[model samples]
Target: MEYNLEVINLTKNYQDFHLQQINIKLPKGKIIGLIGENGSGKTTTIKSILNLMTYDKGNIKIFGKDSRNLTKQEREKIGVVLDDSFFSPILNVNDINKLMKDFYSNWNEKFYYETIKKFKIPDNKPLKEFSSGMKMKIKVLCAIAHEPKLLILDEPTNGLDPIFRYEIVELFNNFVSNGENSILMTTHITSDLEHLADEVIFINDGNIILDVLKDKIDSEYGIVELLENNFNNIKKEDYLKCLKYKNEWYILVNPKYEFQKKYPKLKVRKPNLEELMLLLVKGE
Candidate 1:
């Protein structure tokens, strides 16, 4: 099977933090969610893939070719949306369209206009005058209008309202339905990934701690609730993590053994991605 993006033993070192040996593969036509806490090296890993940051080790391949050796045509097939704005603050939507047209050989003016209209952005307004949400939409429009095969997004949903976020998520879903494109988006919003991501990659302290299919997570990890008093009898080692509330305790467990049968009174239930991530990151 072909892959849209692949990272092999990728490592980057900073003065105070190190992004340890990282390996990830993004299959073609799938939306892979890269979830991590702040300063977890998500951005660093993305920069390494884009060749925007210098890394000490590992190989990055895009479209089955080494990223380092990518020609201009190969580079044009990837669209990137980082946390920082790429367009000039003084430039209007119209100006941005014209500028990007010069950069991407496959830039589709018709698609650009349609995206702008769909997002309800005014072509004449200066980008600085637009709200954060509008600015993000403009970035999205610019990135997608070029008809890139892969999109690398860093916190693309950060400033949007809930309604817009949902709309954007659906847009991404539709975008990948064609099975010729893919996206690798890094976000802290686990809820977004729960619905849209086929695969999930969790990064912590500059290292990948969990990488699995979302469906597997749903089938493997479960939440077990017990009375506060009974919590003391539940072994901590048996659970991935646990939490205590005022009157009850909730634990995340991988119930592959007969342990649940032994503790018949434990209330077992399913957990969403948010709960799983909280447990995994907390190590509680």
Candidate 2:
């Protein structure tokens, strides 16, 4: 299988934080959701992959080319939507369009206008005047207007209302329908990942804790509340993670069916992305 992006033993350090020995494999034609709390190195990993910052160790490859060595043309094949990066807020839709046209040889003018009109974004209004949701919509539009093969987004749906979020999700669905494009989006909004992501990578404190298919999460992974005595009956390797609240224990168990067959009495329920993150990140 071909991968769109690969990070091998990537590491970066700061006075208080360290992105330690991170490895990721993002396959083509899939949406991989990166989930973590603030200061968990999601943005740091994305920045390193884009070569926006230097890493102390490891390698990053995009579209089979070394990320640091990507040519201008190779770099153009990736679209990026950073939470805190964009054209000047004083620039309007038209100004951005004009700038992107000159910057990207593959910029699609027709698609740009079509997306703007479809989203009812004013072509003449400055980005500073737009609401947060509208501003995010514009950012997404700019990222995809060039029709890149890979889209990397950080918190793209952070402040959007449900309606706008739904529209943006639909647009993402359409973008990847061709089966050649892929997206790596990091968001605190796990509800979107619950529905859209093919797989999820959960990062906490600079380490990747969980990497699993969304389908398996829905079908085979589950959480069970067990008493201390019952919890002791299960082996550490049998479950992914465990948390204790009061006298009850919440354990994240994979292959829920097998677990159920073994216990036959405990109730195992499927976990949403947020619950899974809490269990692994905060649990023992």
How well is each residue in 252-277 modelled by candidate 2, as lDDT tens digits? Answer: 99889988888788899989998899
The lowest-lDDT stretch of 10 consecutive residues in candidate 2 is 171-180
In candidate 2 the C-alpha lDDT for residue 36 amounts to: 97
Question: Which candidate wins on lDDT?
Answer: 2
Runs in model 2 deviating more than 4 A are 226-239, 244-249
Model 2 residue pairs with clashes: none
lDDT of model number 2 = 0.91
Q: Return the TM-score for each candidate structure.
A: 0.95, 0.93
Clashing pairs in 1: none
Q: Where does candidate 1 stray beyond 4 Å? A: 245-247, 255-262
Q: For model 1, how does the per-residue alpha-carbon lDDT over 192-215 read when each residue is reduced to its tens digit? A: 888899999989998998898988
Query: lDDT scores for all predictions?
Result: 0.86, 0.91
